[model samples]
Every structure is written in C-alpha cells, then in structure tokens.
Target chain A: MLNIIACFKWVVDEADVKIDAKSRALLMERVGYKISDYDRNAIEEAVRLQEQHGGNVVAATVGPSTAKQCLKDALSRGPERADFINDPSFVDLEPEQTAAILATAIKAKEEYDLIICGEGSSDLYAQQVGPALAERLGIPCATCVNKLTLAESKKEIIAERKLDDGMEVVSMPLPALVTVLPDINTPRIPTLKQVLGAAKKPVDNITLNDLGQTYKPCLQTTGILAATMERRRLKFGADEKNILVIIGALLKEGVIA
Target chain B: MNFNLTEEQELVRAGVREFCQKYVEPLAEKVDEEAYFPMETVKKLTEQEWTGIPYPAEYGGAGADYLTYIIVVEELSRACATTGFTLECHTSLASYPLYKFGTEEQKQKYLVPLCKGEMLGSFALTEPGAGTDAGAASTTAVLDGDEYVLNGSKMFISNSPVAGVFIIIAMTDKSKGTKGLSAFIVPGGTPGLKVGEHLNKMGIRGSVTAEVVMKDCRIPKENLLGNEGQGFKIAMMTLDGGRIGIAAQALGIAQAALDESIQYSKERVQFGKPISSFQAIQWMIANMATDVQAARFLTYHAAWCYDQGLPYSKEAAMAKLFASETAARQTNRAIQIHGGIGFIKGHKVERLYRDAKITEIYEGTSEVMRMVISGNLLR
Candidate 1:
C-alpha cells in the first residue's frame, strides 16, 4: 500500500454528552471532543495494514479547532501522522460534506493507494461516509470489512465484509475504499510511553481554504434539538400498597388466582 | 446456598472470562516457557482496572467483593496461572491488609498504587524458619527513636523481587510473644533492604517469587500496620481471605486440565476407538468433572459468605482445603488418562499436573487448612 488516510471525527465525549434542557440539543458545552469510537477502529486497521504492507497511515479529520485532540489521539494510537481541517463551520457537516472536505485535503499534497474510514460514528451511526467518499474520489468501495488479507505480489486484498445475515468474502484491487467494523482488529491502548510520543509527533493543521474546499453542508438540522428524554417506569416491590393495588387490578381484569 | 450469580456478578464472570479467553489464552504458554512478567498483559489489565478488584472504588479498586475477585482470578488462572498468581499476591496478600486495617493516609500511600496496578506489591510474612507458624518469625523491627530497625530475611515471598512495596510482619514487642508482633510497610529500595535472587519454582514459574533480606533497614514509626502487637492477627486474618484465592486458583488449573483432557480423549484413538469411548476413560473424566464442580461450589460458597460479611474463616479454609487437594487429584487423573502424551513437557495436562501440585502447598498447605478449620470450630 502507498498511503492509507483514515477518516476521524471529533465529537462531544461519549461519556459526557448531555442534552440541553430547554433546546433539547445535545449539550456540548465543556464536553470535550474526541475521535469517534469507530474512527479509532479505522486508524487501528490502517496502522495494522501499514505494518504488514509497509506504508504511511495518515489520519484526517474535519472539525472545529478543538478537534485537533482527535487527531492527537489517533496519532497516539498508531497513525504515521495526522491532518486536521479546522473550521467552526466544519462542526455540523454531514457524512458527505465531511468526506468531501477530507478527500480534498488528502488529495492536495499526497496520493493514497487506499482510503479507510470507520463503518459509522457511534453518535450518528449513519453508515454512509465511506461509500460516499469513495464515490466522490471515484474509487471502488467496500463497507463493513471484518477481515483484510493483502496480496503483496498482486497489490490487492481478500476482504470479508460483514453483512446482515452473516459475512460476505470478496477480493478488491489496491486503490480502494474500505470501511472497517470494530472487530476487524482490537485497537491498541497508548502506553504511557506512546502517549508521550504522540505529544511530540507532528500533526499537519490545514484550513478548509488550504484544501480548496469551502463549507458545504450535506445534511442540516432545523435547530438545536435536545434528546427527548424517556422516563423509566418504576415498579413497586412486595409492599402492602403494591400488593393491594395488584389485587385490585387482578379483580378488575377478572384473573385473580 | 444461593447457586445463581446476581446480574452484576454474572457480568463480572462473563467479562473476566471473555478477556482471558481472547487475550490470555493464546500467550499463556509463551509466558510460562519464557518466565516473563508480561508488561503488555498487565497494561491491558490496567485498562480494565482489574488489579485492585476486591477493594472499594475509592481506593482505586474495582469496588467488587470476594466473589468478583475470584471470578477474575479464576478466569485468568484458567488460561495463564502466572497472571492469576500475580493478582492473587497483590489482592489477597499485599494490599488487602491495608484495606482492612491501615489508616486512611496509609491506604492512600500504599493501597492505591498496588490496586491500580501502577505498582506491584508483595507480602513478607514468611521467613525460612516461619513457613507455617507466622508467630515463629525471627524478623524483628526493633523500635529505635523515630524508626524501627528491621533485621532478618523473608523467604518464598511472592512478587517480592519486582515489587514496589512490601507489607511485612516482624516482632515489635518480643516479650509479649505473638502479641508482640507488628506489621510494616516497607517501600522498595529502602536502604539496607535487598531483594534476593528469584526462586525457581515447579509451577506458577512465570510469577516472581524470591527472598527478601532486611539488614538493619529503618522505616518510619508510622509504617506500623494496625497496633504494635497486631501483626500475627493481621497476617492470619489476611490468610483467611488468601485461602479463598488459592481455592480459586486451584479450580482454574483443574478446569483447564479437565477441558484439555476432554479434547484429547475425543481426538486420541486407542484400541481402534477414541479413548472417550472407553469405560475406564469415561470413569476418569466423570470423576474429574464431579470433583472440579465440587471444588468450584466450595470456593464460590466461601467467596459468597465473605462478600456477605459473614464469618467465613471456616468456610474459606474448607474451600482451600478441598479445592487444592481435589485439583491435584483431577490433574493427576487427567495426566493418567492422556498416558504418554500427558507426561510430555509441552502437553497441557503435563503443565496442569505440575501446576496442580503447588496449590496444595501455597496459601497454607492442605493439611494446614484442616488444622485451622478444626481449630476455629474448637474455639
């Protein structure tokens, strides 16, 4: 493989994401962003491939200035380097738009043999970005790939893609797009040593203007909407009141035994 | 008497079993063959916060009880006895005393690091002369001004050679007899304290077990654990918990051996049929299965009682007694069933047979367990 560019995302921390009480929007204030869980899967897969086939695994993300942390985490994982398209407007881009921005940035200075992205983001779970990005770049795309075995001689791969029923095994040419499932490979934790190394690794910070791509929204929200909180129905224990109420309900329904 | 695990308990078992099956099983042989402590494996465990499992979460532990701790130990032991032995030393011996008796400041200083897997801890209650009778310990931490000058050596101590901290017991008030003893928190690299060469062991060979030599080692007076005359009681109380862990360890090795024997029985052909089809083979497997189940029941019941805060000292010793001895029989039977294959160096049953012998020896001997349990009842 020549180069593998993995698509990453910086979102509100999955653990801390909350909803705004009034607006019903995901409360993002002070909820520091991180790379989407699946995106880490992509980065690990790319790194694994790089280790096997000898190439560079570059991490690319389109997010706000704070999104740089996602690239930092990705580099900490196993990527050769990272590129970030930092713009306030990049925060709300849909799969296609995010892919478009990343594609432009990836194509600007370097040519890649393969483009790898996660099957989907945990927050949105859209399952669209990889194919759409590949279409935009005009390369063959494979999604939900569970296994990747390279044929170094042929410069191709035998991939097993996860399907609804089971798994579909296929082979693809070198210059392709692959969206990986989380099971493709377990992501390695950054050792304290690796974390320190990541702090020093150079990450390229590129603007939307630098990639010759402007803000373009593929999907837009009407307004900031909070999550509709669902209340759990409570069940009473074997207290006297609960027993009496159960007996009353049983008599009403004519099924007391 | 409850046979079913609660939901949280079930989750604990499943999570631990899954982690061990996926991560530990593949590299277990290499770990044993190489005598490696496996930094990568410990790093993975640190991610799950498995190092300090039985203590409260405030102390950097997983906040689980004895049952949950055994679940982790049993699963890890199933694949790799080395890791299980290491965890047992940390949780059941070194750090547990601090959790039960140490002051808040002491816990913060010693317990947190060990429980978080940030630092490995060791227990030094055993001396060459004091193998079974902790009261016979010759190591003395004589009070001198603001410090206690510790002199004497500890032998067959687990995790000592590589440990960051050691919880040691020594005579503080010699005239008071056993009551004269006290425990101390000896930080590694304290001047005059030396970790001797690692002891070569027959089983659980991957985990480091060595001698600790203390030559006029001085520790602050604050290092005393509990009261000045409580060392013997503390060491014995800690062993009550430690016995449960040894039971879990024995069960793990026996289960692995049984599983291996079953597979071999099905695959190995004898007298024109799979050995599994033979009545003698069937009988041996039957005995192993029943014994292993019996051991598990005893171990889990002991753990359950401990979790419920009941008087589990009798139950724990019973569990340790039955499980360790039963594992020895089960592993021996497994090896016999495999015949020549089981005697080979690389065979799983061979390793199990070797591993099974140690469980009966460590954490107090099987004979020692009977004495303790009987002594408790007589009291």
Candidate 2:
C-alpha cells in the first residue's frame, strides 16, 4: 500500500487583515488563521490518491504552537493521521529553514511512497520548499503539477506541469515529491461526522528538541508594509461645456492619449 | 461557564458556512420569488449527512451534538430561511420525537431512514380548531384487528406535501381529555391518507406547508409511538427541543438582515456622504448589531442546555420568543435603512423582512412562548 504524506502551512486569513491608513501597517490583532489556500489542494490530492489506491495519507506541518488547530482541520479533510513539528520560534521561517525542518521531521517518521505540497504557501510565494526538501531527501521532484496519474505498477507517476506558455508532462519513479497547483482539485468540505472523527485520529506532536536540532536563522525579514493607492476624487458637471472641459483635462493629463 | 464552542463544533460551522455560500445563497432569490421547493439543495444537505447531525452513528447520523445541529441550522438560515426551516422541521419536529420515544423496532424501521436522509419526515398535531389548545383535537384512532384506524384532518402541517413519513397525533379515548391522545407513525402512500395542495405564504415560501386529511387511514398496531396517553408529553418535549431550532433560524434571519444593512449603509451615499455617517442610521445599526448578538447567545445557550441533558423548556421558550421578536424588529429596521430599494422586488432585505415574520408565529406563537416561560416560573 502506498503511504503518502501531504505538507501544509497555517497562514493568517488575508481577508481579515486590516490596513492602517497613516502607518500603512497591517493590523492582525483580530485576524484568524486558515489552512494556506493551495495547501488545501495538496491535502485533497493526497486523500484522493489514497481513496483510489488503498493506502494511508498522513498530513505533515511545521509551524508555531498556535498552528495546532490546523492538525484537526487537515485530519478532517480525510487524512488518516497528522505529524506536527511545532516550536514557537519556527514562526516566520525562511523557505529554506522550513524545508530543513520538514526534512528532519520526515526522516524521523515512517516510510513514504510519495510526498505532495502546494506550489507555494499563501503567506509566502517563494515556491522553494518542495524542491529544496526534495534535494535534501535526494528524491525526484516536479513543480507546478496540475494533474497526476499513477502507473499500473503503482511504483511510478506521470505528472502534467502547468507552465507560462504550455503544459509539460514528466514521469517519475516512486519515493518522489510533487508541488501541486490549486487547479489540481477542488477540496471537499468536511461533513460534521468527519469533523467529529478527526478527534479520534492520531496526531504525533514532535518538537525541535525531539529532532535534536538547534535552530539558526539563515535569513531575516525586516518589515512588511501595506501598499497604498491614491484615487483622484475628480467630479465634473453633466453639462456639455463641462464635459468638453473634462475631456481637455484628461487629454492634458495624458490619460486619453 | 465556558462560552466557547468546541473545536469540532467550530469546524462544523465553518464547513456549513462554506456549503451555504456555494449552494444555498445562489438559489435563495429564485426560491423566494418562485416559491419553489429547493429539492436540489435539500439533496445536497442530505449528501452532507446534515439531515441527522445530532443522532448516533449506528443509526446513520453524524453523531454530533445538538449544539452542532443548531449551528448548521443557523448558517443555512443565514443564506436561505426557507431551506433552514425545512431542515429544522425535519430534524427537530419529526425525527426528534422518534429518537426520543420510539421503540427499537420503530427506530430501525423509520428513524434509520430519516437519519440517513433516505426519506423526509413530518409531524402533524395542529387541527383546524386545536391551534395551541392541542387537547381540543377531535381526531380519533380506533383499534381494529391488527391495525389502528386514524380519522382526522391536520392544518398548516409543514412538510406534509413532500414528506415520506409522518407522526400523527389523535385521540385514543376522548373521555380522558389530553390523556387520551396517542401518537402514531404513518408512512406516506397509506390508504385513505391525503395531503392537500401547498399553501402560499408570505415568507419562507420555498418551504412547503399543507393540510393533511385522514379518513380511516390504518397503520400497523406497532406504529403507535410511545404509550397511548403519553402523546401530549411526547409532543410537549419534542416542541421544547424544536423551539431551539426555530430560535436558531430566527437568529440567522436577523443576522442576515443586519449584515445587509451594514453593507448597504456603507456603500449608499446620501447628501454629502454615506448614510452610515448619519447618527440616525448609525444608531439603527448599533441596535441591530446588539440585538442579533443577544439572540445568538440565547439560542446557543438553549442548544447547550439540550446537549447537557438539562431541563431547557423555559430556556428554549425564552430563546424562541426573544429571537423571533428580534428578527421581526430588526428586519423592519433593515428595510428602513435601505430606503425604497429594500422594498423593491429581488432585494435581499425585502425577502428577509418577509421571512422574519413567520418565526414569531410558527412552532409556538409569541403568546404561547410567554405562557410557557411564565408557566415554568409560576409552577
């Protein structure tokens, strides 16, 4: 049976973030967290694969302790179990750091035939974790995959990659990793029974200490400011003369050139 | 007094909200305008296992708590009150009595299908002359051989026209007054059982309501629910739980109205700025926000009581009374906030205003709710 692992992230719901008018700072005091948008597709794809081919799907994540809520959410989406690698200092880690931590955690876990991840996290679109983690584990990796088909032997997979110009098809053997685009699948909303059942699913809480790793930051983020746009609150009368004047102004401003 | 929903309950709420946004909200206007039953959406709900959320897994239910069921109703009603009421009637009024009082055989035969959403269920108690005075029901069920023959006519029975099974209340011995009442399970398509044409209503139009007529309709003797004299008690307890669902429905309607008003006031400019800047509109919004929150607490608290296995008759009555009245009052304010636009056809607030009125009158009227609350205290 194929044992699959789906990697996910917990990010602040961007819809709930508020912008301060003067400081251009994001207000996150009351903002809630959700499973990163594309990661939902990753988890869903893993579950779908398991349903089609008899196997176990385990969801894995590395984040701060606050991200514990996401374990239940991932499990409710049909995963058989969850692996949470939590450390308060893991918040806002660089993509390379995240990949490093994930590699360590996966090495400590059981064997896996395949691994799936989102093309990019909702918070950071770096698109580096999947390839970096694959390099760490010395596994073949494909990025931007929108479709996947398992070989008859269940030891190989054919993937369709979405590119800017066209789609590319590639085949990889078992024990490979793929970063999936959102178009891969529409995630199913969990029924109430599934939500309740998530409570009974086993979750492994692994701390950095358990991995026997000392954290060192290779990169640091200084600040993030909201982009502000200025609107020209121009109004003109509906009369013919004013309309002509407005047209002249628009022409002078090069808006109608 | 931990005032937080469990993690599972929260997840259920989120899932239901997402479902309603995609499936329920898109069809709401058409449902209201055409007075068409949303059989498609109902089927989707059944597929989600929402038809029997609070029942046990062995019985084909979701095995969730009553509070989780209440959350589902609230979120569904937020998108479409008619759809919400349809589910509430099926789960709270029809399926609940069976789960609470049915024999093991009865549950296996009827409750299992109801929980699985294989068949829709209905409860019939009110007659033309009965209204709140349920003891005045003149329907009779006389034993004959291996069956009981039911003769009666029920009015304003929700889900009657489309129901697959029904819980009928009738007198087994009229000389005993309310004590003579008995409840029976009558499957659809039974001989001599007839359902009248659907009734057109002001609000919640998509939910079908009709009259049920029985002329010597005979059900198996095993179809009797509970004991013969226990029908009144069964109905009263069932309604006590059903009121929590209705209250949740009312809270959903009120929340929808407030949501519309808040969004409309912010975008609708008048004079020099948005009407929300005016003190009058702001005050209305403030009152609406407060009232909706209050109703939510009452409704959720009642559901919590039920889940805790506590006596919540008074709590349920209070919730139904307050939430229903709050919905009616807030929807009116919501219309006023929208000016003439709210009165126009196709506007959400207009439909919500109409939908809010029924919450005050159904299950139990505001008068009956007050009587129930006061009676609990006086006794």
Off by over 4 Å in 1: A1-183, A187-257
- Computed on C-alphas against the true complex, the DockQ of each candidate is 0.02, 0.76
What are the TM-scores, per candidate, against the unseen true structure?
0.64, 0.95
Number of clashes in model 1? 4
Q: Write the per-residue lDDT of candidate 1 for residues A64-102, one digit (tens) a residue.
A: 885555654677677878887788766667887777777
For residues A1-257, write the lDDT of model 2, one tens digit per residue. Answer: 77999999999989889999789999999997888999999999999999999899999998998888898899999999999999999888888988999999898776999999999999888999999999999899999999988999888989999999999999999999999999999999997678888989999999989989876878767898998776667788999889898998799878897
Candidate 2 residue pairs that clash: none
Colliding residue pairs in candidate 1: A24-A225, A24-A226, A25-A225, A25-A226
| Model 1 lDDT, residue B314, Cα | 89
Interface RMSD in Å per candidate, to 1 decimal?
Answer: 10.7, 0.9
